[model samples]
Target: MDASIGRTAREQLTGRYVLSLVAFLALVYGVTQDIETVFAITLGLAFVETISILRDTPTVDSRWVGVGLGAFITIASLAWFAWELTTAAGTGGPVWFPALTALIGVWFIFDARADFADGTDSYAPDDMDASEMMLVLNHGHLVVEELRQGPKTVPELADACDLTESRVREALDVATDDGMVYPVDGGPIDDVERYALDESKVGGVAFVRSNGKRILRRIARPFRR
Candidate 1:
């Protein structure tokens, strides 16, 4: 039971499951004339997939992949409904259904884009070089991203990063020492601190804020004049 080999196997299994789910949904839509059934199945499958992603053990892509798949299904559902509306005319069905679906589709597209962009850094810790390792280990860069929205307890951090409590604490301490996070005004019992958004003069300050968070103060590097 080599760990890396097990992770590779899990990755392969997840990929296969995602592909099969996508294909099955497509087939069902193509073969079935009922829009309701299509929507129902898609919704149910998306829910199940989301839950599976969230509950998946370490080494899986988790929520990011679920978000992407959900987005794809949302867009497809919208297109299907829109076609139905156009072909059958207003009398065929309610126009709002398609309209609502279209909105959901657009939202999902935005969500998927953001999720993919965020996950570009989702490699295992061993694969990371020094800079990335610093982010994961010393700076809480990834943890900040995960908890930037609110305060998270140790368990939450563990679940998010697929690491144990001790590791999460070590990382969190580094972040706190570096001033990335601190106790929120009214947060969890463990002096839970919210990860502040880095408002540094660094170019990514704006990007971080765009995703929504309190602007973080800059940690001036020595090289900067």
Candidate 2:
């Protein structure tokens, strides 16, 4: 399962890099064209292909957007170039220069729209912990501090944080998984009399609350360094 996830992530990263490089090369090539027609074709194709890869979806909306932007860039550039050619022949100003300059503007607008709709880097709730704000003020740093003071059972930690015992255990579980806290006697210690909790399980609530995304992030973070 992890291997499949790693493969998918790697493919996406590779596609992003390749698309970016293609876009860059196309844009550079477009700038050197004399008629600006080749520039329009190259620029539009680059934009479409780049955005399609970024989206990684073959949805109708995605296809329509790619087609529309490509057509718009090509048509608008050619039309402007024709007009510029006629004007320059009559007035003797620079031919293709005006069309080339306007193509830059068109490229910018298309790229901006693509970026806005890309959805590649947008934040989802899964990117952050739903319980993080409530329990851990700074990614459970305070909880870790409380744990390091002593082996305060789940209830003491919960009461200290003014949260439910379940919440405290949740926080401690996060701390434990993060290597900030570990079980003292190789496992949870019984303290049902002083602190109300299922002594057998220390971080059951935390583990339950955490979804797949958070767990993966935790596992990957260590390797990122």
Best of the candidates, TM-score: 1
Model 2's lDDT to the true fold?
0.53
lDDT by residue for model 2 (66-159), tens? 3455556667666667776666554455657656755654554454354456543221113335565554545355556565456666666667
Top-lDDT candidate index:
1
Per-residue lDDT of model 1, residues 1-225, tens digit only: 246445544664587787897888788878997778888898887665444434344555544554555576677667767677667543467667766776665554454455466564222234455776665564365577777566777777778878777777767776665355665544465465444434352246644653344322211211123
Full-model lDDT for every candidate = 0.58, 0.53
Q: Model 1 off-target regions past 4 Å?
A: 1-57, 89-91, 116-225
Q: What does the lDDT read for residue 18 in candidate 1?
A: 73
State every prediction's TM-score relative to the real structure.
Answer: 0.30, 0.29
